[model samples]
Target: MRKPRDYDSELKALELKARQLKSRRQSQLGELVIATGADALTSEELAGALLAAVTTHDHAMKEAWRKRGAGFFSGGRPGAGDSAGREPGGAASGAGSTPPPSSEPGAA
Candidate 1:
């Protein structure tokens, strides 16, 4: 008769692999944030921006972003007018000139 499979060990191995993959994904996302110069934003601002992007229903805006992202991955310079023909605040904005939120009094 064939030996029974070690389901418990296989399950544990799969769980470990999942955790490792998740960690790698998070790291890559952090790197991408830095690469895109979005690291300048505070955590709150970043989260808000991501939430907006995720919740947006504008197909045209999403498509423009997708094309810009494709250009970025295909060796295009970051913020180099790759988003020409996009909305006014697109590519040329270059990571935004607005200062990050400050904690100090009268900072604004």
Candidate 2:
């Protein structure tokens, strides 16, 4: 005969796993914010900027923004573009700075 399943223990284990995943996600987001130098802005400013990006539909503008974002993540300076009118020292200032400390307590 097969052994009975411990449903209560299984449920608790699943909940714990979910909590761990959530914590990891928050930690990663915090790191991303600092890495992008977005921590300089207030939450409202960040939300507004993201909302604007989400709502924007200009193909050329979006393409340019995408390139800038790709460059930012690839260890290249932002706005180091061939075109004109880009910000002088926008995201690049923070991109090369030291990474922020981890948010997790007791992290080395």
Each prediction's total of clashing residue pairs, residues at least 3 apart in sequence or on different chains, is 0, 0
Q: Give lDDT per model, in order.
A: 0.74, 0.71
Worst 10-residue lDDT window for candidate 1 reads 97-106
Which has the greatest TM-score?
A: 1
In model 2, which runs have C-alpha deviations exceeding 4 angstroms? 59-64, 77-85, 88-108
Q: Which stretches of candidate 1 lie over 4 Å from their true place?
A: 78-108
lDDT of 1 by residue, 1-108 (tens): 999999999999999999999999999998898767677668898899999999999999999889878888888755534454464544434445223323343574
| Model 2 lDDT on a 0 to 1 scale | 0.71
Clash pairs, candidate 1, are none
RMSD, model 2, all Cα superposed?
A: 6.6
User: Candidate 2: how many backbone clashes?
Assistant: 0
Q: Report the C-alpha displacement of residue 49, candidate 2, in angstroms.
A: 0.7
